[model samples]
Target: EENRKFVLRKFQILYNRVLWIRDIESTIVIVIIIRAGVYTFLLVIVAFYFSNKLPLCDNEMTVCRISIAEVV
Candidate 1:
């Protein structure tokens, strides 16, 4: 019947729209996660490089204090 066909067409359009929205949301989430991971990785690398570059101290107590402060 014409009515049934019209209903089916409407359902298909709605289904397609939902699928598109879901795909867009998934892509956004993936992009955010990837960016966060990259930022974290870069932060760690910079921290490691700075730790090696900076002069701490000869004494154990001074080195511990300085290193702890630098890490934060």
Candidate 2:
């Protein structure tokens, strides 16, 4: 019947729209997770480089203190 055909067409359109929305949501979630991981990796590398620099700074500070003591 024509009425049945109309109903079927509407259902098919709704189903297609739902599928498209679900696919878009999944893609957005994946992109956000990938960005978070990349930023975390960059932060870890920066922290590692700064940690290596701290010991040299401490050594210099100690040398300065010793020189000041000798002068006094």
Candidate 3:
């Protein structure tokens, strides 16, 4: 019947919308994870560069170690 077809079409639309939203959510999550990983990697590299460039003092070394730990 026409009514049954209309109902089926509506259900299909709703199902497709749900699936689209789920896909978008998963993509956002993946992007966020990648961004965080890259940020951490860059931070570590910067920390190493500074630690190497600066002459190590006891206090400065402790501070550098603490900062790196905080980043991790």
How far off is model 3, as Cα RMSD?
11.7
lDDT of 1 at 10: 100
Clashing pairs in 3: none
**Worst ten in a row by lDDT for model 1:** 54-63
Which of candidates 2 and 3 is the stronger one according to lDDT? 3
Q: List the residue pairs that clash in candidate 1.
A: none
- Candidate 2 at 60: error in angstroms? 49
What would the TM-scores of all predictions be? Answer: 0.44, 0.42, 0.41
Residue-level lDDT of model 3, residues 1-72, one tens digit each, is 999999999999999999999999889756655655665567566766888653442347556444544554
Question: Candidate 1's error at 29, in angstroms?
Answer: 1.2
Q: What are the per-residue Cα lDDT tens digits for candidate 2 across 1-72? A: 999999999999999999999999789656655655555455446756888543332347555334433443
Model 2 is weakest, by summed lDDT over 10 consecutive residues, at 63-72
Candidate 3, residue 22: lDDT? 97
Q: Comparing 1 and 3 by TM-score, which wins?
A: 1
Worst 10 residues of 3 by lDDT: 53-62
Q: Model 2: runs farther than 4 Å from truth?
A: 36-72
In model 3, the runs with Cα more than 4 Å from the true position are 35-72
